[model samples]
Target: TRKVRRNFVAEKYAVLIDALYGGRASQYIETQVSYEDGRTNKVAAELRIEDAETFPPGAVKQAA
Candidate 1:
């Protein structure tokens, strides 16, 4: 008998909306996993923050 190992890569994207919840913030994130066997999986989540202002402006800007 032989054992096989699988390889996969994961990519993630996230965004934070300031003051979305009355002085708080909401962060949404999505992740995708791709496997060498042509299989794919996706996951998403949303988080609430109490002090989003602690982050500097343009800290999470998109790439050019």
Candidate 2:
């Protein structure tokens, strides 16, 4: 049997709860990520922070 690995982990990153204040949903995001190669990347994407509260119990939000 063979296995495949994914480079990006979908659940590893997210927006801070404080960022959403009485908002119905998230519209955009600004993030900075550093790879193991010592390179940093900036990206913008549509977000839905409404589920921030529903995240699993042990999920941790990393600092920017």
Global Cα lDDT for candidate 1: 0.56
lDDT of 2 by residue, 31-61 (tens): 8889999999998888676553566766978
lDDT of 1 by residue, 34-54 (tens): 899999998778776664356
* Candidate 2: Cα lDDT at 20: 58
Candidate 2, superposed: residue stretches over 4 Å from native: 1-19, 49-64
lDDT of each: 0.56, 0.61
Q: Extract clashing residue pairs from model 2.
A: none
The reply for model 1, stretches above 4 Å from the true place, is 1-24, 35-38, 50-64
Steric collisions counted per model? 0, 0
